[model samples]
Target: MRFVDEIYRLYKGHFNGDEEDIVAIIVGILEEQSHQDLLKLVAEMDEEELFHMLATYMVEVMKRKVAMDDERPPATLTH
Candidate 1:
């Protein structure tokens, strides 16, 4: 399965409300795997797998501003 598809399968109901969330979820799904393991996994990926990884990380960030309307500001941003 593609990394993107696997992410959807494993985290099917974990909320896909935001593109940024999708990016984070993809990372979360692959989080903490060994670096060598990741390299090995990535090395075997074909163009599509590569897109699954690359496109997943392709998110909209810092567009206009880093904050969202009605979204609570993080503690770091509060004071």
Candidate 2:
């Protein structure tokens, strides 16, 4: 939960929509996992390991977004 809050605080200004909405989306995805699974994963990871995992995930997401942007056609100006 604290990690989710940190994510919201870090990204809220950079992303579209309300901070609460962003937090909700993150938490909602997390809620889809079984509690036992989540606990098992959490128990296996230390704080630093979790941070690195999230950082790696963020980098991958950014790479995909950049690739998508590169594939998009340029906008045309209309008079």
Candidate 3:
């Protein structure tokens, strides 16, 4: 199965009744310019590229979230 299809399958059971597409939520929140284009680019990448991309993107997201949390410490941050 494709990575996205597999993710949908694995999480299908855990999704809330109104929350059908977890991947869409992720993509939707991205800046408007790359919204659909990003997915197209991602689709052409190999597994290794996907892994690194996801890991890097996730870590950056997490770092930003953590930094924004008032209870946490912040450093000069960049994506």
Find the candidate with the highest TM-score and give its number: 2
- What's the C-alpha lDDT at position 6 in model 2? 70
lDDT of 3 by residue, 1-79 (tens): 2545665676677567664465565455444546576677688789998899899989999989877796766678789
Over 1-79, each residue of candidate 2 has an lDDT whose tens digit, in order, gives 4655676787667568777777677777678879996787777778897899799889999999999999999889999
Positional deviation of 77 in candidate 2, in angstroms? 2.1
TM-score head-to-head 1 vs 3, winner: 1
Models ranked on lDDT:
2, 1, 3
Model 1 scores a TM of 0.48
Q: Positional deviation of 66 in candidate 1, in angstroms?
A: 17
Global CA lDDT of candidate 3, please? Answer: 0.69
Q: What is the C-alpha local distance difference test score of each model?
A: 0.70, 0.79, 0.69
Q: Output the worst ten-in-a-row residue range by lDDT, candidate 3.
A: 25-34
